[model samples]
Target: MRQHEAVINVMEEHGGYATLGFLNQEVLKVKDCVWKTKTPFASIRRIVQDERFFFKIKPGLWALKSYKEKLPTDILPTKEISKSQKEEFNHTYYQGLLVEIGNLKKFQTFVPNQDKNRLYLGKKLSDITTISDIYKFSYDHIVRMTQTIDVTWFNERNMLASLFEIEHSTPMYNSLLKFIELQDFYTDFRIVADDARKKEFQSKLSLEAFKPIIKRVGFWSYNAVAELHSKTSELISIESKLRL
Candidate 1:
C-alpha cells in the first residue's frame, strides 16, 4: 500500500502526531504547500468538497483539515421586533405613499426634520428640488410647516396644497397640534393611520382641546391612501392621453 506523499510529508515535518490543529499551524507557517502525492486530483477535489473537511488552497496559502466543532444549539436565531420598530416601519410606509401623491400632483414635497442623506421611498423627498426657497425658509417656518406633519406639498407659488400626518401607532395629539397651527391656511389637512385606529382618532377629536379644529381635520386609512394613489395615477394617465 502506497501512502499519499502529502500525508507523508506532513508526518515527516511534524514528527509523529499530525493532529488537525498541528497541521493547520504548519499550513499557516508555509506560504504554499506543494503536495507530492500519487492521489488522483479527482480524489483530492472530492475530499475538499466535503463539508466535514476544511481544505482550501489559494494563490499564496493552503489550509488543510480545519473543522469547527458543532455546538449543541443554534448560536443565532430570528429576533422579535420591539413596538418602536413596528411604529417606525408603519410611519415609513404611510410617508412613502404621501411622497408618491406629491409626485403625481407635480408639487414639491417637503419632509421636515428629515435627513437628506438617508434614502427612503426610492429617493429622499428632501433631496428633490422644491418650489419653496429652502434658503429663505426659516427654521421656525419649517417647524410650523412640518411640526408633526409627515409630509407637506406646496405649489410653485409657495402655497400649501396638502398637509399629511401619519399617526401609525403614535398618539394623534401631536399631529392635531400641527394641524391647529396651520389650520388658518386654506389647504387640505389629513391624518393618515391604520383603519383600526378610527375610534381612537374620534375619541381624541372629541376632546375639548381638539373640538375647535376637529371639523377642519379629516381622517384617512391606509386603504384610503392606496385608493387615492390609484385614482391619481389614472387621472394623470388620462390627462396625458388627452394631450396626445
Candidate 2:
C-alpha cells in the first residue's frame, strides 16, 4: 500500500474520521506501508494536512473528505446545539486523551466523581480510567481537593505524578488554587485550555498568591496536549513493534 493510503485506510476503518493522535498510534501499525524516514510521525502530520484526502474538523481531529456529511452528530456537532454542548464535547474529548496517555505511560489515572459518568468518545470516562477511587495519599481535606481535579496521573507509589484541570470555559484561577494545596509534593500542575487563553493563564499564574507553587505550575494548550498524546502513543507503538 502507498504511505498516504495507509493513513486513509486507518481513517476509513475508524468510520472515515480519526484524531491526529489516533492516527499517530494506528497508522504506523499498518505493515503494508513503509515509513522510510527518521521522522515518520512528522510525515504523518504532513500527510493529514494534504486536504486532497482529509479535512480538519478541529484541533487534532481529521476526517476523510468523502465522509464529511455522514459523520455522527456527536463527532461533529451542528450549529443548532447550544454552546455549552460544544464545550462539554471538547472538555471530555481532552479528558479522554489525557486518560489514554497516562494509561500508555503506565500510570494510574483518575477523573472527578462528577465526571465519571460522562462520555469520552463512546466510552464512559470512568470506564476508561484505571481507578474508580482517588488514592488516599494525603489528608482527608487534601484528598478531597485533589479528587475533584479534572484528571490526575498517580505514580506506582500511588502519589500524584501530575494533576491536570481542563479549564475549557472555567477560570484558570480556580484550578491554580487546587494546586496550592499540594505544594509540598512534587507534582506537575497543569492547566489545559485553549492556546488563545495562554495569556490569561500567564496573567493569573503571575499573581503573588500563587508564588509558592508558581514555579511548578505550567500551562498545556489543548493542541499541545493532543500532540503529546499522539507522540507518546507513537513512541510506545514503536517499542511494542520492536518486541515483535
Choose the strongest candidate by lDDT: 2
- In model 1, residue pairs whose N, Cα or C atoms come closer than 3 Å (at least 3 residues apart or on different chains), thus clashing, are none
List clashing residue pairs in candidate 2.
none
**TM of each candidate vs. truth:** 0.58, 0.92
> Compared with the true structure, what per-residue lDDT tens digits does model 1 show for residues 1-244?
1223343355345432222322322332233445354443333333334444343321111233432222111111114656665455456545655766688778877666553333332345455535333323335775555633677787777677788888776788888877777666777888888789999999988888877688878999877886566456545644664774
Model 1 scores worst on lDDT over the 10 consecutive residues at 69-78
RMSD, every candidate, angstroms: 20.2, 1.8
Off by over 4 Å in 1: 1-83, 115-122, 127-148
- Candidate 2, residues 1-244, lDDT tens digits: the string is 9989999999999899887878887898899999899998899999999989999877778889999888876678888888998899889889998999999899999999999988765679999899999999989999999998999999999999999999987888899999987899988999999998999999999999999987898899988988888888788878887873
Clashes of 1: 0
User: RMSD in angstroms, candidate 1?
Assistant: 20.2
Over the full model, what C-alpha lDDT does candidate 1 score relative to the true structure? 0.56
